[model samples]
Target: MTQPSDVLYYSHNLNPRVAVAVARHLRAPLRYVRADPMGREREAFRPINPNTRVPILVEPSLTLWETDAIAMRLAARFDPDFWPPARREEVMLWVSWSAHHFTSAGGVLYFEHIIVPRYLDRAPDHAATAAAEADFRTFAAILDEALAGRRWLVGDAPTYADFRVASALPFAEAARLPLEPFAHIRRWHAQLEEFDAWREPFAGLD
Candidate 1:
């Protein structure tokens, strides 16, 4: 008999950037719960996560939020090989890099420059946009250097770092950020698109 392990996902919009990380990391089918524009302001969603964010994981008795936490928990429970080295040190590196560094600087720049202005009708000036693009380019260059002669971030095989970093790239592309400048990063992003799961959420988003 199949055990019932539920994963309810809530996001501001269907294909949220961070939520995709959880989806890819978990390799689990998501049950999408439509998020209110003020979804984070709702107490209803707070029961699952006081912060009230999307990609929240409800696994039987436990509910987890925050992208890396959900990804780490899922990888630990369901995918040991997906997380190479399988050591606490390596796992921490991936999660911390994603949450603090990649998600912090890169994610912030993507939002402030592109997603916010385009989707939410917010005002962002040209200088801010340029700075954001420059930030993304900086991170991309760092990643390109890191991946030289290596296929993945932590090791040869793809790990949580790959998914987390890859998740951010699509937004950059959507923002019209040039990829021609970084061949390795472009190739890495292409590799991630080959997965069926990666294409699933993006199917009808266009």
Candidate 2:
């Protein structure tokens, strides 16, 4: 059987940006395809990802959805350092927390403040934004406490989990994320922002 080319279908959304940043960090020999699964190509992209999400990684005999899963595959294939064996479970701990708490809360704020007002051409839902801000502070406190002395989420260096947790930090300002009180998370995210890949993952995309 012939091996299929690794193609990453991505959008500029929070999750897809993480995938692009990972691929860029790894310098993986893969083709990048910009896709708008939720917008103009919703119907056309359904067959590729039934849930209609981007950051879909299509490799030989496999079509992967979910941002973390895509990041896991990319790390497992190109660089083990990003997903170290001994620290795998520890990394997963943070990834799970992000999906369940931090990122989830942050996504709501982004959607309500940024997405609703800008793309949807409607006023943001203030009630939802206020509720999300409360949740953001609640979860962010946990993250802030966790990062009190650590540079990264799991290991000595940045891991996939770090990217996963920091997924929404880049948009904190634009989304009006309630991050001002979380000094530790702000400090940690500042370090991630130093990286070109994290700062501008789509710098060269056409």
Candidate 3:
């Protein structure tokens, strides 16, 4: 049988959160195909992805778009434990906490304070930025308290939840979001950063 090839076509501006989670968990090295904002300009890419987002994953016979969806799919396929709780109620809790609370809150702060200035060449409005930052801090505080004595997000073991959250840290750092007092968060992030697969993906890009 032929081995499946894993490839991630992405850009520097595109963080590739889902790709990072899958790649790191599976210990699979990714082949990067850097495409312009205008996209690959090929009919092939157009058909595979309608929105034309970066971080498109091309497996040997599967093409996936949408970062979060791709991450969930990969987790289900390779590491079911990474997806969410095997129990239904816990799955609901994870989804509610991550989707409705964490990702939304973090995304606002990320887009307004970090992404806008870098990609759009202008900062977001002060009031809006302030609101988002407050949201993120509130969410972070809850996570920090939950992680008061634990090592990972879901359980003693790490999961995609940790990876998804960690992907936002570089942006938070870029925005000068101070983590000075959050010792557990700092330690958690440091642990995640030590992964060779995570660092390897950006080697040539940086």
Candidate 4:
């Protein structure tokens, strides 16, 4: 019997975008399934992920959620360049920093500016966005300082950490991220934009 390829359930959301990009970049053999967490299939999706999130990877005997874990799994199986071992500690440092300082801050602005207007269709609270923008600027400054002389986050080349740190960047323009003053970060992100996978990971996928 021909076994089915491992499946990846995904949506065109922030983290899923990165996961799909990593999977496609590595040419991982995954059958992609578009899942709607808040749709009628919400109940059906619960069996695979208690969080009812996309970017869930389901293999023949295993199921995994969380974008970082999925990205790491794919890197472990296909390409270690994304998480190079000799450079793994430095790579992980940026990834960890991003979770708490960088992406965490930008995510709030993204939610307030983009999600509120597009999905919720309500006026975003001005005070909330103001606070979020302040937080974002504080962290973005740290990132800017870190990237001043480096093209990539950890090593000479790009890694999963770059993707993790820049996860919120793709939505920057739409989310009104305060990025104009950070030349290094802008230059770095421009390089990532060179990748078709990063530019349009969900392109042509349902």
Candidate 5:
């Protein structure tokens, strides 16, 4: 089957991680446009997305920003199993929680620990790291309890919700996300790593 090649992904940093996973899972051909958020590339991309952030999905019909929305749109179009109607609400719940809560906590550590040092050539803010660690633990506990006996996030199988939530985990080790205490999260994330999309999300990109 020839998948559509209309999806154009724009990302400066690794913000398009979940979108990449969704596209790969759908067997879709995504055109990646790398743009620096703080450079001239941002100015060039302003007409595309005024937010000037990465992970924007541009299709012939619509321009989608926000990782959760992009994941849902791709799932709806290409993979029904990942976005079954009966479990739509449950899947959305996890997606929303992940974007608003999980990533909120984890993104801080990732930015301070990995992004700042790598991109800006600066040291991590210890106070920010400490606060982020505390926030991460609070949210990680909730996630651990949810995954007590489940293999995936929303249903019996992996869905867009799983990909959305686990997106930041690839940098967990490097960012020091403090996942040691959440055995279930660790186990679940380990399972996510088995997927080619999660393992090498940027495989074909420059």
Candidate 6:
């Protein structure tokens, strides 16, 4: 099969690690378009995605703004291990849950600890962090219980669901995401790090 070379991946303000992992799994080369959250770059991206979010996938035939949707589309075409037909519903459930709950909470800590200090040159918001911490723990506990003896999120093998959920965990320590109580999640994330794609999701960004 011919890999798509004209694919442009826009990511800057928000993390695109999951998209990077999917690209790696597909062995597709992505032309990255970095958007600056604080500059005119975000405005420029509005036409592409009215939500003005990064990690937007643009190709000749399609434009995908949501990360889970992009993962599903790419996996449907390129990688079966990530998106088997029989497991499609389960995969979507986890992906949706990650976006609605997990990532929302994790984004708070990531923005406070990393994005604010590193990019925005500002102090972390204590009130926001406190609220996010509570939310993080609530979701983390649910995930940890689900992962009690399971190594993967959906099936025996690692799938898009695993990638979607674990995407935010790379910043766990740096973001102080209140993960110390979730051993199962930590173990699962460690297993994900064993994959080359997961380990270096942001490889060429420098």
Which number leads on TM-score?
A: 4
**lDDT (Cα, tens digit) per residue for candidate 6, span 1-206:** 77655554556334566787777767666666566433567677788788777677888877887777788878877777788899899988898898889888998998899889987757899999999889889999999999997889998999988888876788788888888888999899989888887787556763
Local distance difference test, each candidate: 0.63, 0.89, 0.66, 0.88, 0.81, 0.79
User: Can you tell me which runs of candidate 3 are displaced by over 4 Å?
Assistant: 1-4, 14-18, 37-44, 84-96, 204-206
Tell me, what's the RMSD of every candidate? Answer: 3.5, 2.5, 3.4, 1.7, 2.3, 2.7
Supply the TM-score for candidate 2: 0.93
* Residue 36 in candidate 1, Cα distance off native in Å: 2.9
Q: Tell me the lDDT of candidate 3.
A: 0.66
TM-score of each: 0.79, 0.93, 0.78, 0.95, 0.91, 0.87
In model 6, which runs have C-alpha deviations exceeding 4 angstroms? 1-4, 12-14, 42-44
Residue 102 C-alpha lDDT in model 6: 87
Could you give candidate 3's per-residue lDDT for residues 1-206 as a string of tens digits?
A: 55447777676543574475456567555566666535446565677777666778888888887666667767767777776547434444655576666666666766777678766867587787677667767777887787787887776676766776666665666664556777778888778767665445456453
Clashes of each: 0, 0, 0, 0, 0, 0
With a 3 Å backbone cut-off (N, CA, C), the pairs that clash in candidate 3 are: none
Q: Please give the ranking of all candidate structures by lDDT, highest first, separated by commas.
A: 2, 4, 5, 6, 3, 1
Query: For model 2, what is the alpha-carbon lDDT of residue 28?
Result: 84
List ranges where model 1 is wrong by over 4 Å: 1-5, 12-26, 118-121, 202-206
Candidate 2 error regions (>4 Å): 1-4
Q: Give the range of the ten consecutive residues with the poorest summed lDDT in model 4.
A: 1-10
lDDT of 3 at 194: 77
Expressed as tens digits, the lDDT of each residue in 1-206 for candidate 2 is 65339899998888899999998988887788998888799998899899988889998788899888988888988999998988999989989999989899999998887778778867888898888888889999989999997888887899998899999999988999988888999899999988898999999884
